[model samples]
Target chain A: MDFFQTIIALLESTIRLSVPLIFAALAGLYTERAGVFDIGLEGKMLGAAFAAGAVAAVTGSVFIGLLAAILISVLLSLVHGYASITQRGSQIVSGVAINFIVFGSTVILGEAWFRQGGRTPALSGDARFQTWDLPFADAVKDVPFIGPIYANLLSGHFLLTYLAFALVPISWWVLYRTRFGLRLRAVGENPGAVDTAGISVIWLRYRAVICCGILCGFAGAYLSLAMNAGFVKGMTAGKGYIALAALIFAKWRPVNIMLACLLFGFLDALAIRLQGNPLPLIGQVPVQLMQALPYILTVILLAGFIGKAIPPKAGGIPYVKER
Target chain B: MSNPYAKLPNWAEYGLIPLVNLVVAFLVAGLVVLLVGENPLNAAYHMVNGAFGRGEYIGFTLYYATTFIFTGLSVAVAFHAGLFNIGSEGQAYIGGIGVALACLWLDRTMPWFVVFPLAIIGSAAFGAMWAFLPGWLQAKRGSHIVITTIMFNFIASSLMVYLLTRVMKPLGSMATQTRTFEAGGQLPKLDWLLSIFGLNIGNAPFNVSFLLALLAAFGVWVLIWRTRFGYELRTMGHSPSAARYAGISETRITIIVMMISGGLAGMMALNPIMGEQFRMQLDFVQGAGFVGIAVALMGRSHPAGIIPAAILFGMLYQGGAEIAFEMPAISRDMIVIIQGLVILFAGALENMFRPAISRAFASFGQRSAAVQTKGA
Candidate 1:
C-alpha cells in the first residue's frame, strides 16, 4: 500500500514536470516541421516566463500575463524567422544569438523594473495559475486503486497541464490530417517541392514559427505562473535543451514526444526522491546519474546504439530559391 | 554586364562589412541601455574606464581574453573543417578534471614548469577524449555533432557535479571544490612583464596563460593557413564532394578536426584552473565555451580577427562589471545583451548591409573607371 502510494505520487510529479517539456517539444515540432530548426526554443520560453511573471505581478491578472508571454515569445520567434527565413542566415547561429539575447535581456530588464535582483515579485491570488480539481475528485479520494489513479494521479493539475496533454492528440491530428500540416511537413522535408507546388514556402515557414512561439509562450507561462511562484533568473535551466533532446528521442512524433517527456519527467522525479535514499543492491544512488540519464540516452539514440533519430531533411539548411 | 555587387574586394569583405555590423550591434545595445533609463554615453564612459583605466583592469581584461582566445580558436579550427564543435563547453568541463588530476597528483612532487606541461597534455587529452565519441559518431555513424555535443555538455556538467560532491571534495570539507594546489600547480603572475611598462597588475589573476594563449593563436594561424592538412580541411569545408574527388578521407578529416577543436577547448581550462583559482571548482568554465562561438563569429574565424575580438569581449566583461557597480539600474547582464546583439549582427545577420554596401562600392568604382578612361 505504501509502495502504491509512492508510485502514484511519483506519477503525479511526472505529470506536473512534463508539462513544460511537452509545450517546448511541441513548439520545436512545429518549427522544425516547417524546415526552420529553432535551438532558440529555450530563449523563447525563458523570455515568455519573464514576461508572464512580470506582467502578472504588475497587472494582477494571469490572462494578461499569458497574453504578454505569447506576444513576447512571438516577437522573438519573428526575429528568428527574419534571420533564418528571410535573411537566409545560419539557423543555428541565429538561434544561439536569440538564446543569449533573451538570457541576458530578461535579467537586465527584470532588475531594472523590479529592483529584485533579476526577479519579479512573488505572485499571489489571481496572478498565478491555480490548479483545477476534476469532477468527483473529492468523492473518489476515499476509494482504492482506480479511485486513486483517477483522482490523485489525474485530477489536480493546472488547466495548462490538461491543455498540454490534450494538445498532443490535437497536434497529431493537425499534422497528419490538415493540408497546412502537409505543407509544413513538405517544407521541412523538401522546401523546393512545396514551393514548386505553388505554395509560398516562406509564408508557410513563418506560420509554423508563429505556432512554435505560441506554444513556447505556454511553456514559459506554465513555468513561472504554475510550477513556480515567480520568475527566477535562469529558472528554465536546460529544460529547453532537454525538450529538444526529447523531441529527437521521439523522432519528432507528437505522441512519442509526450512519452519521451514523461520518461524524462519520471527520471527527474526519481532523482529528487533518491537524493539520500539507498537502494538494496546499488546502495546509495547518485542523483547526478539520474539527472544525466536523459542526455546520455538521447546521445545513445542519436548514435544509433538503440535506434536512429533522424531529423528533418531540410531542418538546418536555409531555403534558397535557385535563380 | 559588370555587376559590382557580384564581386567584393578583400578589404570590403573582411573589414568594412564587419565594422558596419559591429557598429549596428553596439547601436542596438546602446538603445537597450537607453530603454533602461540610463544615459548610453555615460554607461559607455563607465564601461571603457572600467576595462582599461588601470593596470589591474587591463590585467583582468587580458586574463578573460586569454580564455576567449583558446575557445575562439577551438571553434574556428573546427569551423574551418565545416564541423560545428558545440561540445567545447563539455570538453572544457572535463578538461578541468584533467587539470585537477594533474595538479592534485603532481603539484606536490614536481616543479611548476614540469607540472604545467603535463597539465596541458592532460587537459588536451581528456578534452579530446570527451569529444572523440561525438566526432567518431559523426564520422562513422552519421550522428549530428551539434546535438551530440550539446548532450555531452549536460553529461559533463552532471559528471562534474557528482565528482565534486562525492569524489573530489576533500574529506570533511564543507565546500564542493577540491583543495587548493601547491606552488607547483600555480601559474606565475605576469607582473614582471607588466612592470616593463611601469604598471602593476595588483591582485589580478593575470598570469602566463595569457602568453600561452597568444602562442596558441600563432600556432592556430600557422596550422590553418600554412599547413597541408589545413588546405585539405578547407577543401572539405568549402566543398565536401570536391574534397572526396580529391581523395581526402572525409571520415578521417572529420574526426581529426573535432579532436583538434576539442583539444583547443580543453586548453581553455588552464587559464581559470591553474592560473586563477589554483584549484578545481564547479562552474569555472562559466560560459566561455559559448563566448568562443561569438568571438569566432565576430572574428571571421581568423586568428588575426579572433585576438582583437577576444580582447573586445574581455573589455565588455571587465567593463560591464564596473557598469553594474556604478549604475544602480543597469546590471552585469547588460553585457550579455550586448554580446547577444554582437552575435546576432556579426554572425546571423552578417550580410544585412552587404547588398547596399556592394552596390555603393560598385557604382563608385564604375565612376572612377569612367574618369580614368576619360583621362586616358
Candidate 2:
C-alpha cells in the first residue's frame, strides 16, 4: 500500500478500536460530572455485551438485542446509583462490586445458557450489525485524496460507530448548554449548593447515571453485535478502565474525551501492528512494551508530569441532607 | 447523647454485623445456585467437604489463605493511613521478577536459608519501589492514588509478560516462563512438619509461607496498633488536619505507608514462587491483589478480622474448585459470583441494614427500661 493509503487504513483501524472507548468515556463523563465516580463502566459494558449477544442470537433481532443490552446496563447503573446515593455507601466500593458481579455473572450465565465456554452462540444476518457503505462511494472511488478518505476512512463503519461520533457534539452541547447540565455540574461541585438552590441532587445524579448507562449499553452492543460475532468472557477487557483514564485525561470534558479516546485508540492500533514487527532502530520491539504503552501514558498523564488533573471536589463523597 | 446500639456490646458492633452480612451474602449465593438447578444445601456441604474434609484439603485452604493474608495486610495497612493502594496486585507481580532475578543469580550457589532471606528482601524492595512512584505522585503532584495504582497494575502485567517471554525465558524453550529455580531456592513444604504430628497433607502446596503469613499478621498488628507510626497513620486517616496539627508530615506518611503496604504485597510472592510454582511465570498473582481489597474491607482493616476473612475466601476458592470438579453444573465462574456478592454486601452495602438493626435494638432496650420502671 502507498503512504496515504497506509495512513488512511491506520486511521480507519483507530476509529474502529476507539468507538467503544468513546462511548464508555462519555458514559463516565455524565456520571462523574454529577458527582458520582463510576468505575463500573466496564461492568455495565460487559453485562450489556453478554445480554446483547445472547439475546440477539436467540431472537434473531439485533435491535431487540440492543434494547436488552441497554435495559441490563441501565439496571446495573440504577443499582450503582441506589447503593451510592440512597444507601450513602462508598461509591468506589459500589463500582468495584458491580465490576466483580458483572464479570462473574456473565460467565456463569453464559456457560449455563450456551454451554460454549462462557461464550454466546455466534450471530449472523440480522442478528449482527453489518457495516454500511455510504452513498456515492463507488462514484468517488476514482477521486484522489477525498476518495480514499470517504471510502476507507469515513464509510463502512457499523451504525453504532456513527452514533458514537455524533454523541460527542451532543454530549458537549448537553453538558455545556442545557439547564440540566448546569445543575449536574453544580451538584458535583457542591451538592449542598444544588440542594439549597432547590434542585433535587439525588434525582439529577440519577438522571446522569441513567444517561451513562444508556451510552455504555451502546458501547457494549457495538462490541458484541457489531465488532465481534458473540459475547466472550472478559471481552470488555480493560477498555472501561482505559475509558476512565481517558475521561481523566480529558479533564472530564466531552470533546476532549474524543481526543483522548482517539489517542488511546491510535496507541492500541499501533501496539497491534507492532507485534512481531521489527522497528528501524530498536529492532524487534517487545509486544509487551507496546501493550504497556497506553497504561504508562495514562500514569504519566495522571501524575501531572504534563498537566494537572483536578477532579470534582465532591466526586467520591456521598451527599447527606441537612435538617 | 448515648446511642443505644452503641451501648449494646462490642461483639455486636465488631463481630455480629460482619457475620450477618456474610450470612446474607451466602443466602444470596444459595439462591443463585438454586436458580442453576442445584441444591443449595448439597452445594454448601460439598464446599465444606472440599475445604476441610481431609488433611490435603485443609492444606490447600491454608495455602490459598497465606497469599490472601499478605495481600490483605497490604491493603489494611494502606487503609489505616487513608490511602487506597489498589496496586498490590502489580506490586506483587513485579516482586516476582525480583524473586526470579535473585533465584537466577544465587540459587545454584547459596544455601536455602540465605537465598530465601535475600529473595524476600529483593521482592519487598522491588514492590516498594513500584508503589513509591504512585505514592509520591499522590503526595506531591496531587494525583489520585487509586488511578495511579490501577494504571500501575496494567504496566506490571505487561512488564512481567515481557520479562517472562522475551527477557527471562530460557533459551530453546517455547513457554513464557523463566527457568525453574534450583531445589535449594525453593521453600520447604509443611509436609515434614505435619509428619512430625503423625499427619500427612498429601500433595497440597501448603508450606512454611503459612508461618510467614502468621508472623506478618502479628507484625502488622504491632505496627498498626502499637507503634507511634500507627498512631500517626490512624490520625491522618481520621483527620488530616489533626495529624498536621500533631506535626505529622502527610507526604512522609503517604510515602512510608505505601512502601510498607507494597512490601507486604510483595512478600506474597513467596507463597506462589518459592512455595508452589518454584519459577517465575505470568499471572502468578492472579486476582489475589484485588481479593485483598475485599478481605481488608470485610476484615474492618484489623489483622484479627483479616485472618478469618482470608481463610473464608480461601475456602471459597478451594471449595469452588472442588465443586466445579464434582458438579459440572456449578461452573468455576459461579464461585466468582459468590465472591462478588460477599464484596457487594460486606464492602459496598456494608451499612445497608445497620439502621434497621440498630433501631430494633434501641426499641427493645426502651421496652426493657419501661418494664423496669413499672416494676420499680
Candidate 3:
C-alpha cells in the first residue's frame, strides 16, 4: 500500500513535468510537418518564459503574461520564417542563430530591467497559474484505488497542464483528419508537389511555423507562471531539446509524442525520488543517468537501433522554385 | 530578374559583401543598445578602448582568440566535408578529462615539455573518440549528424558532471573540481612575445597556446587548399553524387573528416586546462564551441579569414566585460546578442543584400563597357 502511494505520487509529478514537453513537441510537430526543422524551440521557449515572467510580475496578470509570451514567440518564429521560407536560407543555421539570440537577449533584458542578475522578480497569487481540482476530487478523496487515481493523476494540474494534454488529441485530429492537415503533411513530404498543385508552399510553411510559435509560447508560460514561480535564468534547461528528442522518438505523431514525454518525465520523477535511496540489487541510480537518458534514447532511435525514425522528406531543406 | 548566382569580382565576393553584412549586424545591435536606454556610440567607444586600451587587455583578447581559432577550424574542417558537427562542445569537455588524467598521472615526474606533447595526444585522442560514435553512426547507419552530435553534447555534459563530482573531486575537497596541477602541467607564458614590443602582458594568462593556434591555422590552410584529400572533401561537399561518381569513398571521408574536426576541437582544452587555469574545472569551455559556429560562418571557413574573425570575437569578449563594468544598464550578455546577429546575417541571411549589390555591380560594368566601345 505504501509503495502504491509512492508510485501514485511519482505519476502525479510525471504528469506535471510532462506538460511543457508535450507543448514543445507539438510545436515541433507543426513546424516539421510543414518541412521546416526547428531546433530553435529552445530559444522560443526561453524568450517566451522571460516575456511571461516579466509581464506577469509587472502587470500582475497571468492572462496578459501569456499573451506577451505568444506575441514574442510568434515574432521570433516570423524571423525564422523570413530567413528559411522567403530568403531560402539554411534552416539549421537560422534556428541556431535564434537560439543564441534568445539565450543572450533574455539575460541582458532581464538584468537591465529587474537588476536581479538575470532573473525576474518572484511571482505571487493572481499573477501565477493556480492548479484546479477536478469535479468530485474532494468528494472521492477518502475512497479506494480508482478514487486516488482519478483525484491525483487526472486532477490537480494547472490550466495549461490540462491544455497541454488536451492539445495532443486536437493536434492529432488536425494533422490527420483536416484538409489543411493533409496539405501541411503534403508540403513537408514534397514542397515542389505542393507548389505544382497551385498552392503557395511558402505561405503554408509560414502558417505552420506560426502554429509552432503559439504552442511554444504556452510551453514557456507553463514553465514560468505555472510550474515555477518566476523566470529563472535558463529555466527551460534543455527541456526544449528533450521535447525535440521525444518528437523524433514518437515519429512525429501527436499521441506518441505525449507517451514519449510521459516516459521521459517518469524517468525524471523516479530519479528525483531515488536520489539517496538504494534499491535491493541495482542500488542508487545516478541522477545524471536519468538526466541523460532522453538524449541517449534519441540517439539510439536515430541510429535505427530500434525502429527507423525517418523525418519528413523535405525537412531542413528550403523550398526554392528553380527554373 | 537578372542572374542572382552570377560570379562577382573578387573584391565584392570576399570583402564588400561581408563588410555590408557585418555593418548591418552592428547596426541592429546598436539599435538594441539604444532601446535599452544607453548611448550606442558611447558603448562602442568603451568596447574598443576596453579591448585594446592596455597591453594586458591585448593579452587577454589574444588569449580568448586563441581558443576561438581552434574551435572555428574544427567546424570549418567538417563543414568542408559537407557535415555539420555540433558536437565540439562535447568533444572539448571530454578532452579536458584526457588533459587532466595525463597531468594527474605524470605531473610529479615528467617535465613540462615531455608532458605537453603527451597531453596533446591524449586530448586529441579522447576528443576524437568522443566524436567517433556520431561520425560512425552517420557514415555506417545513415543517422543525421546534426541530431546525433547535439545529443552527444548533452551526454558529454552529464558524463563530465558525474565524473567531476563523483570520481575526480579530490578527497575531502569541497569544490567539484580536480586539484591544481604542478609546474610540469602549466604552460610557459608568451610575455616575452609582448616584451619584444616594449610592453608587458601584465597578469594576463596569455601563453604559448596563441602561437600554437596560429600554427594550427596555417596547417589547416595547407591541408585544405593544397592536398588531394582536400579536393575530395570539397568535391563531396559541393555535390555528393559527383564525388561518388569520381570514386571517393563516402564513408571513409565522412569518418575521417569528423575525426579531424573533433581532434581540432579537443586541442582547445589545452588552452584552458594547461595555459590559463592550470587545473580542470567545470564549464571551462564556456560556449566557445558554439562560438566556433559563428566564427566559422563569419570567416567563410577559410583559415586566413578565421584568424581575423577569431580576433574580432575575442575583442567582443574582452570589451563586453569592460562595458558591463562601466555601464550599469548594459551587461556582458550584449556581446552574445552581437554574436547571434553576426551568425544570422553572415550565415543564414547571407544573400539578403547580395542581389542588390550584384545588380549595382552589373550595371556599373555594363556602363563601363559601353564607354569603352564608344571610345574605341
The digit string of per-residue lDDT tens for model 3 on A3-110 reads 889989999999988999999999999999999999999999999999999999999999999999999999999999999998877888898899988988898889
B78-147: candidate 2 lDDT, tens digit per residue: 9999898889999999888778888888988987788888888988999899999999989988899988
Against the true structure, what is model 2's DockQ? Answer: 0.67
lDDT for residue A18 in candidate 1, whole number 0-100: 93
lDDT of 1 at A66: 94
Which CAPRI category fits model 2?
medium
The C-alpha RMSD of each candidate to the native structure, in angstroms, is 1.7, 1.8, 1.4
State TM-scores per candidate: 0.98, 0.97, 0.98
Q: What share of the true interface contacts does each candidate keep?
A: 0.82, 0.72, 0.75
Q: In candidate 3, what are the lDDT values of residues B1-376, reduced to their tens digit?
A: 1344778898888888888999999999999898788999999999999889998998899999999999999999999988998889999889888899989888888888888888889998999998899999999999889999999999999999899888998999878789999988999989999889877899888888888899989988888899999899999898899999999999999998899899889999999999999889988999999999999998989998899999999999999999999998998889889989998999889989988998999999999999999999
Q: Residue A106's C-alpha lDDT in candidate 2?
A: 91
Residue range with the least summed lDDT across 10 consecutive positions in model 1 chain B: B1-10
- For A1-323, candidate 1 gives per-residue lDDT tens digits of 99999999999999999999999999999999888998899999999999999999999999999999999999999999999998888888898899999999899889889989899999999999998999999999888888999898999899999999999999999999999999999999999899888999999999999999999999999999999988999899999999999999999999999999999999999999888999779898899999999999998999898877889999988887765
Cα error, residue A66 of model 3, in Å, equals 0.6
Local accuracy by lDDT, each model: 0.93, 0.90, 0.92
Model 2 vs truth, CA RMSD: 1.8
Evaluated on chain B only, what are the TM-scores of all the candidate structures, in order? 0.97, 0.95, 0.98
Assign candidate 3 its CAPRI class: medium
Which residue runs of candidate 2 sit more than 4 Å off their true CA positions?
A: B1-8, B192-198
